[model samples]
Target: MLEILTGAGLTTSAGLNAFIPMFALGLLDRFTNLVNLPEAWAWFSSDVSLWVVGVLLVLEVVADKIPGVDAMNDAVQTVVRPAAGGITFASGIGTETTTVRDPDALFAGGAWVPIAIGAAIALVVHLAKAGTRVGANTVTVGTAAPVLSTAEDVSAAALTLTALFLPVLVAVLVVAVVVGLWLLARRFRARRTRGRAAAAPGGSEWTA
Candidate 1:
């Protein structure tokens, strides 16, 4: 379903950066016909909300670019990212005004389902991101901060745009994220295995 895909994309984006999707949704909803937010969510697109979220996004971006600060930011976002994902997913899908011309036909229920699903999706993504970040920071001695943070920000932005314009294409971003996370996880596991082996009774191990 396009509606579900839209939710998936938005939530996935949130997992990477909490405010990017929210800010994009608000701007698009306010300026273009790409999104028609529900009446109850009108405040989300208001000038006040936009400014507030924009500021928060700026702070988040700056903080995420530093190695140690990034880990702390991730700890803080453990709650924010999921909450943002839930809101975006629920709003994007539950309303029949976005995703497809006949969204009403596909989305007949409330946002609770999408919210739960979005939160779960975001939590998994958040954990993967955090785990990989910790590993990368350890391996690169904090030198990977800006590069990885920028990559995540760019990915989030792209995912948000795709979710808004072509909901069906969201699957591509999902697959990419899955693959990236899988590779990172594999590398992390290999490193851990090597660490354990090297510590075990003089197992053959070399460090460069």
Candidate 2:
């Protein structure tokens, strides 16, 4: 139960920023005895993976702050984020069991369940993120995107780190963030529609 919650939290975090969970895991594994990777997953602890993920993390942060670039980046990550979520979920489960250590279990039947759940969660979050970002760009004219990106990065980092110790809280926070963003996006779209309607031919327009 705890493992599942932790995995879900990690998956949620990955959906927001795919590299954050991986980087957090790698950092914990390298600096402390907090996390132990399976034998097959030992590469996550290697300096090379650390450096690569770290660099990508930096790139993602910068890209997410730019208006047009962030949208393109999100589109490109449509495939990548789900995969990262699946991996993070699997790793979370793997941390709790010795089954992951067996090469044969990598492709075993039951292993796919968590992966699928993670992917689904990630896809949902990704879609929501894309919608919200598009709405934000339209409403704010890209002026607030950098601020939004910064908040998202901080949230991702907080969720990733919190998943290590307080997964239930992370889950609550993720739900809150997603729901709040969805509501705000919906409101923006509604306003946009009304504005367009008012500007249409034969529609009322105030001169004052």
Candidate 3:
């Protein structure tokens, strides 16, 4: 189970790492009586519900592709994801119930571990992708870069759903997509930079 969680964390970080913590929190909420809201969210009602997980997974993918919309989504999700991850981790620590015997104690006991793990994974994923975006924007003034980012968003969503539904297949696919995207984005950036440099005045060493 630890191995599975670790692998899932890595794969999720590749795309929707920003939301992994939130998803984890949602999972936590299902196990313990930490948050009343998880109970309200039908999809997060049960840990074993494939349908709900699948829907959330799909949303993660869609959220990644909405052009400038992802920036807004990221801002909103930064807080939401960690909260969700905390909730999921808390839920995973115990069983669901209308009331928790000792909410503070239970949270302190075993809930923090998974929440920390999930949040760490999410932070790494967001940083990597955010770095990539910053590099891309520096090279290309935020033009069609959103298209590539959108692709990554979709990939993240697919990987999440696939990991839940078909772990083995998704693992292979995620690795392939990540490698492919990295190469493609690098090449695209290089070409754009070269083109920009060429269009400028003095060869590739101009000041402005």
Candidate 4:
């Protein structure tokens, strides 16, 4: 139960920022006693891996803050985020985190199941976020790009930490992410529809 929550939280955070969960998990597993990664996954906490993840995270952060570059970044992240989410989710489930007692029995039938489920979860959240971002960019003329990116970074970091140490709170954060993204997407869609309707001839929305 707690293992699933941790994985879900990590995967969800990956949807927002691909490297945060990885970086956090790696650091904790390497430096602290909070996370004991399985032998197969121990490489995540290596110094070299941390450096690579950090560099990618920096690049992702900078690119996602720009206007047009953000869109392009999202396009690229459409793939990277899902992959990262899968890895984080699987690692979260397989690792012995502070909250994850007896992580081995959490999931059966090999690692593919958790990986696939995590990928799907991340993909859905990513879609919602991407949709909301597009709408936000359109409505604000890209002025809100930096703000949105910063908010996502904060949320990702919070979720990663909570999922690792205080998994009981992960459900609340995941729900908030889902609801926030859904609301933003709907609001943007409504605004875009209104804009389209107003622009059509005779205020008609029948344009093909």
Top candidate on lDDT is 4
Regions more than 4 Å wrong, model 4: 202-208
Each candidate: what lDDT? 0.83, 0.79, 0.51, 0.89
lDDT of 3 by residue, 78-178 (tens): 66555554444433333222332322333345545756765555554455565566556556556555576666655665664454334456457646765
Off by over 4 Å in 1: 95-99, 105-109, 192-208
| TM, every model | 0.88, 0.88, 0.53, 0.92
Better of 1 and 3 by TM-score: 1
Please, what are the lDDT tens digits per residue for candidate 2 over residues 1-208? 5566667778888888899998988887778776776565678879999999999999999999999999999999899899989988877756632222222234346878878889888788877887898988887888878988888788878877777667658668888879877887988787677667778887664411
Each model's RMSD to truth, in Å?
Answer: 2.5, 4.0, 8.4, 2.8
Model 1, C-alpha of 207: deviation from truth (Å) = 7.2
lDDT of 4 by residue, 1-208 (tens): 8888889999999999999999988888899998998777798899899999999999999999999999999999999999999999998887787777788565676769888988998898888888889999998899989998999999999999998888899999999989888887888788778878878778855532
Which scores better on lDDT, 2 or 3?
2
Candidate 1 global lDDT: 0.83
Candidate 2: worst 10 consecutive residues by lDDT? 96-105
Candidate 1 has its poorest 10 consecutive residues by lDDT at 102-111
What's model 1's lDDT at 64?
Answer: 92
Supply the TM-score for candidate 1: 0.88
lDDT-better candidate, 2 vs 4: 4
Candidate 3 TM-score, true structure as reference: 0.53
